[model samples]
Target: MPKRFQSVEARKLIQVSLKTNDLREARLLTGKMRADLHSEWEGRLNGSASPAAYPPDHLDMTLEATEAAYSRIRPKLENLAKQQELDNQQAYDAYLRKLRNTRDDFLRAKACKPLSVWSDLADRRISKNNWILPQGSEGYDTFVDMIAEAAIEAFNIEIARREGQFAAEPSSLVVKAGLKAKDDTAKDGETILDLFDRYAAQRLAEGRKREDGITQDRKVIDSFAKFVGPRKSIKGLTPADIRDWRDTLAALPPTYQKAKAYEGLSMRQAAAKAKAIGAKTISPVTVNKHLSTLSPFLGWCVTNAYADRNPCDGLFFGIVKGKNPRPPFSKGQLEKIFASSLFTGFLREGQEHKPGIQRADDWRYWIPIVCLFTGARVGEIAQLRIEDIQLDDGIPFLLIRHDESTGQRTKSGASRVCPIHSELKRIGFLSFVERQRSRANGKATCQLFPELEPNERGHIGAKPSRFWRDYLKRIGVKSGNDGLGAHSFRHTMADALRTAGYLDDEIEVALGHNQKTVTAGYGRVRQGTVKRINTMLEAITHSYISFSK
Candidate 1:
């Protein structure tokens, strides 16, 4: 034979719990697992030995398990009846009542327990109420009742007896199911464990509030399951799989009205309650969200020592690079930029702003206002909490942050607090805060402009793009370029500041860009620079209300 290559030992070394009876089977599973990968096991042969290795409780039984249990206890019940025959019939009846009471309590306690946990369904029963007297003369007769207080405690001890064996071998769950039993309950599809792990870590790292978002993650996972091969693993997600998912999601455009989402989703709805934006094409922002969700899952495995490397590090979006990433806004398009930002939306029937240019509690105006003044991303502005704001000496400021795979890590791996204006503060911001406090306990979020709709529950809906587009058209503005939106706020605000004589360093601080340098070091807020940030804010918010000659 040619030179032999020493194969790496694929057998994983593990500690077997003394509680398990299938140590030999577990070892065999380890040997087979040694082949090409070291990962989570899927099918039952892996460590979780099948019932074939051991017999199950009620290995053969009828569907009416409760009735079957009652029937089995009937003989013992009759023997007790015979022993009590000579006693006062009423006393015998009283004794039976106590037994029945004890039995009812046992059923009540164990009903919630999984059937597998109880191999013998004899645990469930109940009896009718009754009264009885002792066998002695009526004057000396003792009262007997159904109060089985001490007996219930004893019955509980007996119920605990099965746990030692049943917990050791859970194989009874499938075996008892008979023909209905499955080899495994986990479906053949992609899962989101790693995805949530990574994104959760990013949120924590960025110091952002972390909430478990199972619904959204499930939407992506269940849809991906149908298209992926059987028994698919998330770790084995292929580029083609991502490409197909993206194309499919792209084909099914979201609708303009959020209400339309309630009708139903499709055979492969990857996004939950994802309403279509009125725009004809999917914007770069929207596409990036899909990537953000999928890529981080792969990243989670790498950071957690699960994988040697992140598979997402090299994966590119789309065949066309420019098609995926959005370019930063440029100069010379200030008015069009403002117009796009001011978009009011399509003139749909009975669906326009309610007799006012803006919704009463809308974030559309405030969000753009923040962008116009601070040049920060929409997401950064959107995630602001009232507590996160700092104000002192007639000034308001924001703690600019980027929630990454972990919530705690701010952008640039650092947080910078930026200032705000007296005028902007005057624009009902505090009144909005008071309103939030009243509804704090009952809303998606108290102390934020984007209050969660009670009906939608935990979902966060974006401000409508229609109102912005229409408002922009009303303001005589057009995008200088074909593809652009609220992001233009950064470019417009930057240019306006440059014209007002702020240097590039000042502009970078205003935008909270992730640049490292001596000036950026000073980007840290000084004790009294709220005045400076306020000055910067006053510089931008002056002309939003339109003027006429």
Candidate 2:
């Protein structure tokens, strides 16, 4: 076994018998066995051993599946050859040169690090299928091998065709014509779902979308695909189809996707069930969210010539906004929240509601206060590193930015510097920062709230948000999803700033909202800008509740 294979668990190892007495046959069998072991070990090392982590398509390692995967990309190879033949002599020579360069690059990459090359091809397949594959799984490795084989076969065929010799059997003219006809048909014969996958991949690759956002958009699009029949082509999409989907979405119950009652049922079927049960359906706002995702997707399809026009155009004009918008925390609610056991006193770490002498200075204690003053989102505050707190020309400010290495992301992909409010400084926020720094002991990358771990979606704030919601209920300030929770603190800050006579742009800058005007991107937030924001923050007053209490 290789040194790499040593890391694999002993339980995963298998013993095989050649089951032959002949020496020559035994040698051949042993060699084949060795190769198989190596492939399996490589697959395990690459992280493909877990079947649960991959999509269903990835699990299929059959020869037929491999051939089908190859067939999907064969048209592009054939089209390249056809184009070279039609071009002028100079253009033809250029085409050959390009192919030679491409082949050389491919060969070099394969020879140096073959798995990476194979993995790249496998990624393309996964992207086309709209499935995410864990980089190193047995299934992914299998697909990589299959794709590599297909790609090699394709290169060989191209090489032979270039040499004016048909080394392998060629497709019949009838078959070729049928394939060409298929390609000529609607968007290279790709389904609406297929085009959506491509659009999603492009968006993700361009950093235009986040993984969480992509996951959400995928859910909406997948539901839409199911509603319209997954096999439906992009060209066949009509305004009527979109309207029908919107109507169906409005009729379905909230969280119908995860509800046990609606499990294994189609969208129409679930909606029908919801209607029969007289259950409360999703709001117009929720319906619009689905449309919002689809509208841009369809727009992309149209831009790419997959469709004639976006069917979702002007569809949102009909959706009336929901009446129950999230409102800011009331003055009385703020009083009760600050006076809660978590702040004044708590029995212990976990039991935050019970009255006791213990006053915890953790996320539960500080996150809300930081949000109340800075107007930063709960997630933003929750993900703050010790280094994020800094002083700019005697003005202490928070550097709110997306750090990909730390998995901290801003909502708008834009970073902002927000001056620490005077109230927070007066109440010992800076002292808290120093204490955290002391605890970190010069570790610049240490998180301010290290106790808060990221959830499955890589959101550090999710658990804290849940804790806030539960705390709100315990303190009788909120009940259920009554549109009042941690976010209300941000809303409260915005309202307070507005009441303090701050301009909209100034408040937006303080709150880290993505600037819409071109001039907003002129320069970095300087010391003067930080001072102005600090002055604006100081203007905010809550006379009803005293922090000194």
Candidate 3:
């Protein structure tokens, strides 16, 4: 019998029965069980490999639900007639007007009761407006008026109960309303905001652990909500509405544009204010991003039957031609960058020019330098644990992986190991690792760069990327139409490798890219293949490489 394994996540101890007495067979069985345990654990942490499709039962509307609601109102009206006391028709008319005004007050009130109460009030308002007053010869005038007001009061109370503003369970009237409700009438007619919440919740249930993506989605969706009015029904959304919103996004000023009066407003609100102030329009790429995020959200609406179709399905802003590709740092720019005060030390206003890496011991000096050779993402480098840098057969390698326990995630959710470039080794990279290890008493879990903490949104590399962007500005490396930034280091490496005659596969492997063809995915890269990649990485040496003491 093998030792039992307890799962903290499931709170259960797993026991395997090998059903064998032979020692060798039992050992083999135990090894297989351990391997299975590890695979299952990793799968759970990373999320399900394939999520089950949602059932379409949510779309069903039974025949009973489809009947006319007006027919059901007759009985309630008859019951109200039996309870009527007022006989003066003129006085009754005045009383009905008062009820109308009271219902209007509830509708326009700043704070509503619970949703159910509010919805019921809205239903009564509709019914009252449609109710014909019994004229000079007609009878039951007071009964009709009283029933309408009763419905309003009953609904207000239901809202308080459902919204958790009160302790009581739903009233008999509320249950009757529910029983008579159509799919379209239920849940206050499924507003766009309601669908957005459901979409976000479904994504979370599907094991989406990152909030950054959802936060971005909310920004786009919230702007749409503000445009359409929060209570607008999903059924009311049209292609025209989407087009109008798209145009609004296009005319909106860049998010970074600022005005003193709009300081505390949301990004969308600030953009609107800035636009009114005649600020410059945002880039087409940004407008496109808004549409792209919106497309999927609307698609989800369609899937869940909230909408007949996605309004944003076929819309796109045309990107202008000849935009400056984020070009690789020119050879001259690279030289100036490494030789700047950031590397060699320089002075500022009222301050001494502190020279060398020691004065700037954080990401300011190291992240870019590491990026220059390895072409690793600022995020991948920033979140690195000490163990991520390891010696494989006497060659140092950088391991980029997604570890949920450490709140570390990879862009593609795939892990890769790249050999440390020889240039990085010569520049005291190993020495820095040694110091970090000694400081932590040789603990491999220590961060390679402890100074860089995760940002408010929990992205470990977000602030570091900003720091690098500011550094670029300091060195006069403005991000132009070419889309150039820290990521251009990757393009620079790929270009250098191509110039050195490395195959595309070797470059792709070194850069942590997916092997393009089906054949490339058949098996693991040969050890000899890695040796070739390491050679290609070494060839990235510069015409102006200098990191001396």
Candidate 4:
């Protein structure tokens, strides 16, 4: 009987032949040998034991000499381990990308039927990667578990080869990297969800004066969390995971669904239901928005040391410039909009539906019109107060500023004055304001459009946008699946300005865009500048062919 023990740290073997032949005696000898070997190993581990002795002729080739050699090579070994970790990450990302590309090609080649119908095809494709168990099949969970184990085993083997020491457990490595294990919380760092909440709260705190992006960031982070998995470790979130999430986003349905059938379902469930019903997919720009929002949060994670890297750093969805999802309205479309029942006669006072322009100063009536001339965002126009309308030396303009008093939201330096164009004055806008002010009887009403109110989400434009969409449908306008909704009017204004030979700066100023220049940081745009802007805006003229007429 032979008793054998290998020392990983020493890169040496201990072998002894037991003189006894009986099974009981052999077992006793094995236990004794293991205890002696472990005692030696413990001494070596604590740097207290002498190296293995060698023959006089081989004095330089002993275990002590080898340990000295290893000491000289330790830094190289550490570098190799780091490089191996990087290589593993790269390999995993490449494999995931290949899988995704294969799946996409397969779906394109065959008709996209139900999951069950393509089960065999998926199995066949997955087998090419040598996944022992099939995807979407029995013991698939086991397959996933085995793959993770295999990866860890490979990593451990590499560590042992390089360092001449057996690697620690995979869970320990993950914990050391500041990521949680599946069954255990990480001792080093916080969970992704916790970090996300803190990140969101921090943003909210920073933007206490204006919180336009706070809700949007929360929504996008929620989507990212859901896509990756609720309990996934932030430190474990790889580039492969981000790629998978992006692929999932490509297949997802539009956020704004026409049907209300899947209202109460989760985003995942709703997406599945939407696909089942053949609902439209979201645009590349929207997918990019999802990426953009998530990237900053991951960057924040990196800053806080919760994550080593931002997985979404350079990844982007390619957008075709001419294939704009949200195209501006044509002149004909604008005419139809102004000639709609809401503007003509169907709108009535106090009643939701009546025979004449009911709420004359309503946001629903004015926002689209305001968007056409000023190219302002719907939220900005929707949340306007009476005080925002300012008159400077007989010239009237709208001061689109972020006012905490009125709960108006705007991005940093999204404050600019847009001169009220000639078309708005022609449409009785100033007259309507005067009437409302007269009715207020010296007490100023806070809101410009008193009929409009904020929704539960605290977005002033939400309800009005819904109502506008329904109105678009009622007026026989095909609001394209691409973001060409009521907001297209803003695009239309930009196009109109560009068509009229307006400079890019002029257009940016009109839209209250945060100018990225030293001069822009100087002071408020002068009243003279507003007058010039109104001249550029005056070029936006559409001859209405009224349905009422």
Regions of model 1 farther than 4 Å from truth: 1-218, 234-292, 299-371, 374-461, 464-487, 515-528, 535-549
Ranking by lDDT: 2, 3, 4, 1
Per-residue lDDT tens digits of candidate 2, residues 346-387? 898778988888888788888989888888899999988999
lDDT of 3 by residue, 1-549 (tens): 122323225545567687766554455456656776666665555664223332112111111111222234435444553465537787556545554565466444423332344335433533443433233312222222223433444444433433457665434342344333333232563666557655765675565534567767887888787777665667667788888788767776665535456666755576577678887777778888888888888888888887788888777787877855656787887877787777776454212123433445556668888888887788898988899998777789888877777777777556777788887787788888888888889899989898889877778888867666666765676654446677878788888888888887767777877666777657765223445557778777795756752
Q: Residue 368 lDDT in model 1? A: 66
2 or 3, greater by lDDT? 2
Residue 238 accuracy (lDDT) in model 2? 81
Candidate 3 residue 162 Cα shift, in angstroms, is 40
By lDDT, the best candidate is 2
Candidate 3 yields a Cα-based lDDT of 0.64
Full-model lDDT for every candidate: 0.46, 0.75, 0.64, 0.62
Minimum summed lDDT over a 10-residue window in model 2 is located at 169-178
Candidate 4 lDDT, 1-549, residue by residue in tens: 122224425445556787656544455456656776777767666665555432221211121122222222445445644554345667645544543464454344333333332344334423543434445554553233222332333344334443445544434232223212332232332656557656765565555322446666766877777766666678778888888787667666765434477666665676677688887777677788889888988899899887789988667887766766667887677777776667766755433334564444466667777777778778787877777788976778888877666677766534677788877787777776776666666455467777778886678888777777767766767644546676787788888888888877877777766678887668764323777777788887775534232
Off by over 4 Å in 3: 1-186, 204-209, 256-260, 263-276, 321-325, 348-358, 479-482, 520-530
